[model samples]
Target: MAESRSETLRVAWHGGDRFEIQIRGHSVRVDEPKDFGGSDTGPTATELFVGSLAACVADCAERYLHRCQLPAGVTVTARYDLGLQPARLSKVALDVEAPGLPEGLRESFTAVIRHCPVHNTLFRAPEVTFHVLTSGHEAVCHHP
Candidate 1:
């Protein structure tokens, strides 16, 4: 095994149900639709979460095709089911289409794409901790 690496994403509220995310010098926004009391400015956080998985699968498939000198035409569609009680995602389904790929490599292709990081993470959950800060200090400084 190798040493683990960490990355950070910064998110700030941008009024209402909207938030701005900053990652590696790029900015993305997340919000709810108008029906959910949001301005419909961007995709909701749940959408982004599933999008990451789909994108990872697509990228992995494309890389495998390229490595084998095959024509690249990969598409991944993802659908998720939300669960109640705790308001969490319960299941995710992915449909991957790799047109023009040879028939013999179908199983291999599936195996490779299944190893995508986002998909593997779902199998082994990560630990999370929350911290609250006030003013410029650690949960103590007060603001006026």
Candidate 2:
């Protein structure tokens, strides 16, 4: 049987282009740069998006090394380019480094990290739907 899971996050505006996000009991803040008219308090959401991918890849690499009974030291540097026409990310590149990795294991390690959940998600886009709720005495939360 396939395992199923559900995750939810809440984001609330914290004044002037800043937002506070709650994720599984941890809180993170995100804001735009001063040039973008924000207070420059924290990383932008776009940066977090790319960072999540990098972290996921690194985590996969580390786990693979641990399973092999080797030191799980992994580093991932990520770069992305934005497409102005669509105002979206057009290119993303990741450079993963695992020092002292055996040459024989390099190919397998690369293959393992490439299958990270974040990488898989980007390769297959998920459907998104939005529902708007307005304040009213009779309003109630609905799940679908």
Poorest stretch of ten by lDDT in candidate 2: 132-141
Error of 1 at 93 (Å): 1.3
Whole-model alpha-carbon lDDT for candidate 1: 0.93
Instruction: Give candidate 1 regions above 4 Å deviation.
Output: 1-3, 136-144
Q: lDDT per prediction?
A: 0.93, 0.92
RMSD to the true structure for each prediction, in A, is: 4.1, 4.9
Which digits, one per residue and each the tens of the lDDT, describe model 1 over residues 14-117?
A: 99999999999999999999999999999999999999999999999999999999999899999899999889889989999999789999999999999999
